[model samples]
Target: MRRTLDEFNDRRWIDKDGYQYVATRLGEAIASGIEDLIERVETERKLRSVWQWLPDAISAFPFETWSDLTITVAEPDAPYRPVGRFESLLRETTTVRFLRPEVALMDLCFDLLYQLIAEGVEMRLIDRPECHRYFLSTYPNRSSEMIRQDHFTILEHDNLPSYGTGLLDDCVTISCYERDSGTVHALIDTDAPAVREWAESLYETHRADARRVELQKSAESVPHD
Candidate 1:
């Protein structure tokens, strides 16, 4: 389910704008599920989020339980660094692909990626050219080393949109995110096979079209000063 649907469906709760409405079982279940997930995903570091509005203590979710993970981060929510769940997902997934330009370059997230790469996880990162410039600059050496040992690929895009995602192993659990009140919203789903398929298929198209990122200084060799 995309955020658009939620925004539209949620409006049904209040026929009058901004008016509070009673919660139904389905609505409560959805809210409860979100809280439980945030608790698990944020297990520690205790990141306060809207998803954690419920009173119960959060539960810890193991990464191994998910066969796939797809993450989308709105630009507004790209800066804040999240702990726990991501670490687990990074460690568990044999293959991870990223589409968020800003988040992909953040140290909080990418710094932890080295360990996964060292452990033989394949990570394919895609982002806009400007955002990925720093990455491509220092990538040649590392790419040479890891490409042979593990799957390490970076692609350059010129005009990617605000919405972005990461498709993990097989297309099982896909995580969705947005922003409100300087906090990031989260959604992790395992039941949406159709969504998973669409995400993977979208990534495939990008993969087919994605070009290797590289830097070329000049066509002619620089003359001695």
Candidate 2:
């Protein structure tokens, strides 16, 4: 006896568990592909020079989560020209201008992570100092609304001093103070091989700068007595 179309489409075949099972299978396939892609990327070049790997390592998870991914690089040579009311703060504080580059990089990273999570991406790893020690609130309804209301702060930290709403995207904001001399040497996208090359270029540039700074400091520190 042949089964009817209704039987084929019955609850037995279309139950929640069945749907989960199919999703699980597809997720696994996607995860495997991502892993393979990462592996090939790592193998083709030296992984040590890739800065984006720091964030990518944290994002790699067992599930298929990420969709739209973007990597932004700050123009290192550009002078910090404060926008709007930020101009006053830039004039008042010495550290703020110096740290603008670092702040911009952190802001970009946080914004991307927040957007991904809002779109239903589960975070696996985030190396930012702020997110390292704590797990931010993940309540969808509250978090989603909060993100929509305050996404601008991520873009402009000069206006918003702190995340007042408990629903703030914690991935970008660091609770502890960082002492890296206020410079973002590089930004990377692990998914793209070209980004790795860019990271290498930055690494070289910074290495040269470090050597020059050390020599100058050494010269200045010589016993003047």
Which candidate comes out best when scored by TM-score? 1
Output the worst ten-in-a-row residue range by lDDT, candidate 2: 162-171
Model 2 residue 220 lDDT?
38
**Residue-wise C-alpha lDDT for candidate 1, range 1-225, written one tens digit per residue:** 446545646755322236544555665677788887775565333223322431121123333333232333333545433333455556667887876535432334555676678877887877776655544344545434444553777777765544455677654333333433423344343434555555676667777777886433311122222
- TM-scores of the candidates are 0.49, 0.22
Candidate 2 on 1-225: residue-level lDDT in tens?
Answer: 125324533523322354342224545565588887886565434323333333443245222212222223233354232121122222232121111223333343444445544555422221232322111222333333423432211111222211111111211211212235443333322233333333334333433332111122322333332
The lDDT of model 2 is: 0.30
Clashing pairs in 1: none
| Index of the highest-lDDT prediction | 1
Off by over 4 Å in 1: 1-83, 104-106, 136-150, 170-191, 215-225
